[model samples]
Target chain A: MPLAATLSSVPVVIDEEKCIAHKGCTVCVDVCPLDVLAIDMLKGKAFMKYDECWYCMPCETDCPTDAVRVSIPYLLR
Target chain B: MKTVEWSVDILVVGGGTAGPMAAVKAKERNPQLKVMLLEKANVKRSGAISMGMDGLNNAVVPGFATPEQYVKEITTANDGVVNQATVYAYAQHSYRTIQELDRWGVKFEKDETGDYAMRKVHHIGTYVLPMPEGHHMKKVLYRQLKQKRVEVTNRVIATRVLLDENGAAAGVMGFDCRSGDFIVIRAKAVILCCGAAGRLGLPTSGYLFGTYENPTNAGDGYAMAYHAGAELENLECYQINPLIKDYNGPSCAYVTGPFGGYTANNKGERFIECDYWSGQMMMEFYNELQSGNGPVFLKMNHLAEETIATIENILHTNERPSRGRFHEGRGTDYREKMVEMHISEIGFCSGHSASGVWVNEKGETSVKGLYAAGDMAAVPHNYMLGAFTYGWFCGENAADYIAETYPAGAKPVIDQTQIDLERARVEAPLLRTDGLPPAQVEYKLRRLVNDYLQPPKVTRKMEIGLERIQQVRADMEHMVAGNPHELMRAMEVYHIADCAEMAARASLFRKESRWGLYHYRVDYPQRNDAEWFVHCHVRKGADGEMEHLKRAVEPYIVELDDTEKSAYDRLRVKREPAIA
Candidate 1:
């Protein structure tokens, strides 16, 4: 059952300049229903770790620093 | 490895439409009780109405329709295998629930005279109530929750309902996605309002997340209820909606149908008399698409500009708002083009059709301290309005049960052995850094569901589906989760696999075709009301095998004459002869 890392353009993106995750804000990651976004321990920024995105907008709407933007997945668009 | 525990009078799992109302009503019922509303996501927006609903699909406004009428309609729409008692309870309280939401700052479409503006979408009665500004519904509910002082826990995914020695619900178990801490909450009464088993089927688009449901509802509630020894009814009557082709969201016939938009075939002719979403209507939709007509569309081009604009405004702003962008990308405009429609991959939803955790009129599941409502609860056509009403029922009822079953120096017992095993199961994926990816396992599982259990179900295919699902169950042991985010998905794969197995089992248990396309077994091609009219229920047995039972359809309180009984079967309007 060996698995390989699959890479693709994630639908949710965070603007690091606006992202305040370094300041202990995990709003986007916390509010996302699918839990696709996670805090990057190295950079202390939130990033989409899973490609499965419902595009339900809770992540974008609840982001306090206005750091998140949701794009329709490239495959569907 | 860290463990957190909570003890409360009532624990409401899920913060979606029903869970919010349940929390609010429970608090309002008995202010002394400790009510905790647990959510996998934030309560501000979650579950089926994360973006809020476009309209109340089943509103029984007093002047527009009576409780009896709404009950009868649901009885027929579900193809007759409904517990009228459960639907009747919702009907009796439908308008009151609407008024309560209205007082809480939720809006519904109103006529010029200030009365509720109701529209007819069903075959016989008027029920649909549009809320063009319904996007703020969750905000309204969240405010109520805050005002009522319901403890809200966000980001905790509940995996199981802990059973007492007597088999009643005692507590629940799961972990927090943020810190990977094990969570075990104990309660006197537990209400499960987790929405549909929506992620059971892979969308035809081949994209994992483009599901008709919010996708967060991976049927965790259904699996938990079954494991708790609660009966789940009518699993074979799968929810196969007519949705936007590539986007996999609803084409929203309910929103546009009242505005003169109808489901049309390739020639752009109306096929069904009613725009309501019943299995029979969906059967016609499936047929037309497969016929020479090939593809179907939501026809609105014939409508006036004003009507189309109103429809677009409501459709683009509420429910699945990304739909507008999907339409834009496809170059689809309601003013000139018909929106393409397709049969969605199947799943179980009591909200849309009759397949969910079985509950009586009081919203109580067979498990004594356990109650269920909303899409997960087995009440036919229990849409957003029904969810709210049933939530109210469950809240007050669970509150009463809590007071009655109050423990004096008694505590909810936990099986430490079970807890250790669950912790091991949740942590295994994280332990193995390079095993089968959660997404791949989920994709393969749902694809297998689509391949083996999609409607027009054949016995051999379903049996094969059961075998493949067992393999998925075994493959789950080798699943990999790089972080808590992926762990959430890995756990969701378990729920989806359980749904796949139970779906196949339920489809096979019923020996005759019913609900049109929902249970149209190829081998058993005709509807056999005599032998298969009873509701098929499944639960985990004492032997740890899936057990099936037959529950008789409660005698209808609202008697339908023979013509009314078959009203849904006549959805196709008669076409007149053409003159030479």
Candidate 2:
């Protein structure tokens, strides 16, 4: 069986301009209970690595630059 | 991956509401003891109250309600199958826990006179205490743990409790979710506070993680207890709540009910006189949804502008804060349209309903040296406060048990064979590349759970559910994980499978319908107190099969009158009163 990449509108979005992950801040990634967010090593910004989210909002609330926005997951919305 | 070994005086698994309290209290009892708080996620934000709570659902504050009254209320609420001693113990210590949290900077809604502004939500007592600014609850607990110097280890998912030759809890074994490194922790005792089996049933949204309880709580502790020879009580009495339809958060009757918002039908008429969460209340809600006036809702459209704003301010800030955003996305405003509500999927949770690892008044499970608290422990309607109080009990009692049973510098002598077996089981998913995805396996298992095990349960369907669950157990061997995170989910699939089997088998064993809608059986449609009134406990039998037992309900300390015994049965409004 072959597995292919699936597309999803990720709930946690990081504004690259405001995200300070390039400055070595991992607050959002560390605080997410689901461990969904990760620091993009190439882009030097935070991104939702996995589509699995509880919409519980620790990532959005703890972001220092106010760059993280957690929208309700599309399936739920 | 290399194996990591840790030895401590006491190991408290899960840093949720109860686990933190258990660790902190154990340390307070003896500051020299090395107490470790192991968590599946970061301790700062974990467990059921990960996002903080809105109110204490069962706060038995003095002057408002006594321990005796609270015991009687829970007894009647759980349909008289409660161990009154456990509920009474919580009641006696409720105020002390409140004061401790208060001293630690937690806020509560109080009147101008500095009295706890208690609200009447239950059928018989005033227990609801609102926490308007409760979003910082975890921060407060984290600060306490830090101050106490409790050892904290995050991202380690403990799968099984290690047992000694005498069947006593020696420690625990699992692998770290992020690194895939096997972990072995040896201790004199182990406390299991892993929250509800929230992932047992997939949400109606078809989203796997959108469960009412925090998605991380995959019934890990319940499975751990059973595998360690601990007995689980009331496995058939499932937790079914009235939640916001697709979002699966509480429409929060406790918060809105006090402000005059209520559960209403399609015509916007009150059907249930009380909005408190009880099996009987859910039964009425289910009946209303099934009737011509289908799609029950949280009706707040009739409330005054000021009241709605106040309610929104609190509801949007605590507990499931994203609830407001979900409503906004759907264009459903409290002042404009009613919030749609539906009955939640079934799972085992003693916090809301009575289905969990059985524990006595001291928070000790049948297995020696193993303690359980919080949502997973079998204490009915315990809610958040009960978790804290029971955590205090488990922490203090386990500390005493360690002092009495094990000498200082007593180290656990664990069997290497047991550790090797669990490691192979945990690592098998990652070793296979061509195998089923954990999510797909979980989705199918939970779908089957809904189809055959969701209640008004039929005997034949449940038996079929048992067979299907066993099939999933077989498929579990082939469930593959691409990474450690997926491995964590794969392990959770195993836990959910165990719970699904427990739910089906226990539901079949009861032989009678009880707890209103919770354990309603289609075949055994009547409540038979003559033969089925005892607590139904399930555990791993000596033959390695799931075994069922009928433990007689502990004799009641506070007896109830005939009228009080049937209080929850009368939740439906006598007349359909509609707002003009």
Candidate 3:
């Protein structure tokens, strides 16, 4: 299949300054139900890689630094 | 990818509510046993109550409610088609389960005098017990699992239950959702707690992941058990909940009804006498929505400011916590505007409705060496507490089954051919680099379900739905995954299709309109008790065909009087004098 780009806004927003992925923390990525969060290796921070999210927030609540925030998806809002 | 194979004394599939309980109790029953709890997501946060529950929907506390009364209420709510033995068993043990969780640090609402703050939510009985700080529910269960030393394996999507030549459950086969490695495990006994088929119907929002159920539970247990030759009961008694419109979460009359909130219509007047969830109640809700006074709402504006604040605190903090954000985005203020309500898409769940793989009071299914409990198991109206109590029973009963017939000499036999077949089936999407996306296929499948299988069900529409489903079944071969994540969705599509066919077949077989909005067939629009009072069980026949057969509903141990039997049917409250 050819590569294609789609317009979407991810629900999970991570603060790179507070995200400890650079120090080897994957808590947000591990707890996500949809597995949509991935580490952006270049920035050494976690980011939402996919648009699919249930918004049932373990990622936000369980984060050590309170770096993660989940908003209702734009389509749903 | 290489296949990982292992053997255990017992294997518990699903680490959600009941699976962890089953695994813990199995080890507690006998210390010298190898038990495994397999989960598709992290066990710490998975299943229906992943974030946590707001309250216990049905708690039969001793002073507040009794076993007989609880049984009687469920029988009436289910329209008298209940197996009283199964329900009565849950009722009898319900308090013990509550106490056990309480001791393990799960919070429940209590009065100043230290008694349980039991409240009235159901039509006739007071069963709803508030758990305002119940957010740590999963963490408490995780503690018990670790204390019992039960083995936990996360991210393995169980695809099939392997059976021996004699047709008894021998083991299970699947693949890791993250690694794409095939997994096979042999066990003396297998317990499935894979929750409701929440993804069977497409949401109105058109979002694939926005489902009433934890979208991860795509009816995997129902499909795997059916393929293992287990009989599933009452597939037509679908779970159709009344949820917040578009947001698809509960307005939760269960929590706020005790605090003075009620379900109202466009005129801001009360309709139903009770806020309890039943097929009859859902039917009334549907009728009100369609009757020119269409589009219902949850009325809370009349309550005192303090009461409204308390209601918002719990509703926004637990269960589907993101509900608060959704309300904010819609600019819904309980102090001013009534929150809109709508009927949810259909699915199968014994926890809410009576549709699941059949199990007896002892938690044994038709097939030997197989046990099931929780939402997937067919015990009428067995909510969260019921799941815990039944999980306890299954764990203990399975321990006995394994102790009697196991590694001594009666070892479970493994069929290599079945494992190889499942490996190829799971890997098919990954192997095909170019094909239809799993998400698109699932979206199409669920949309067809909504078109034909949603309530006020029409015979012609259901028949057409089956035809579309069959065409989709053929297209399963063309599903290709972009990566391991997509592969998980690909596997889920197969399970969703299995549930859709079961729903269609069972709906067509009943031939009578029952369960109100759940199986409201337009062709046969009346309850035919003389012909359809029996439970319809569906399973795979010898020739690879879907077979439907009727079984007699067990004689009620606590019989209902005429008034009690018709309680649910009369949900619509009458206005004094005349409304015309």
- Tens digits of lDDT, candidate 1, B1-580: 6888888888999999999999999999999989999999888778899888889889988888999998889888877888888888889899899999999999998989999999898899999898999989889998999999999999899999887777788878998987888898988889999999999998888888888898989999999999888999999999989988878888888888877788899999988898788889888888889999869999999999998888888888888887887888788888889988898889889899888999999999999899999999999989899899999999999998877786565655666777677778777888896678888889999999999999889999999889988988888888888777678889999999889989999999999988889888999999998887898999999999999999887888999988888999988768898998
Q: What is the C-alpha lDDT of each candidate?
A: 0.88, 0.92, 0.91
DockQ of candidate 1 against the true complex: 0.62
lDDT of 3 by residue, B100-211 (tens): 9999999999999999999999989999999999889999999999999999998888999988877888889998877888899898899999999999998888888788
User: TM-scores of the models, in the given order?
Assistant: 0.97, 0.99, 0.98
State the fraction of real interface contacts model 2 keeps: 0.77
What is the C-alpha lDDT profile of model 1 across A1-77, one tens digit per residue? Answer: 55555579988989999998989998887767777888998898999987878888778877998889887888777
Query: How close is chain B to the truth by TM-score, in each candidate?
Result: 0.98, 0.99, 0.99
User: Which scores better on DockQ, 2 or 3?
Assistant: 2
Q: What is the interface RMSD of candidate 2, in Å?
A: 0.9
Tell me the spans in candidate 1 whose CA falls farther than 4 Å from its real position.
Answer: A15-26, A39-46, A62-67, B407-409, B577-580
Global Cα RMSD, each model? 1.7, 1.6, 1.2
Better of 1 and 2 by DockQ: 2
- Ranking of candidates on lDDT, top first: 2, 3, 1
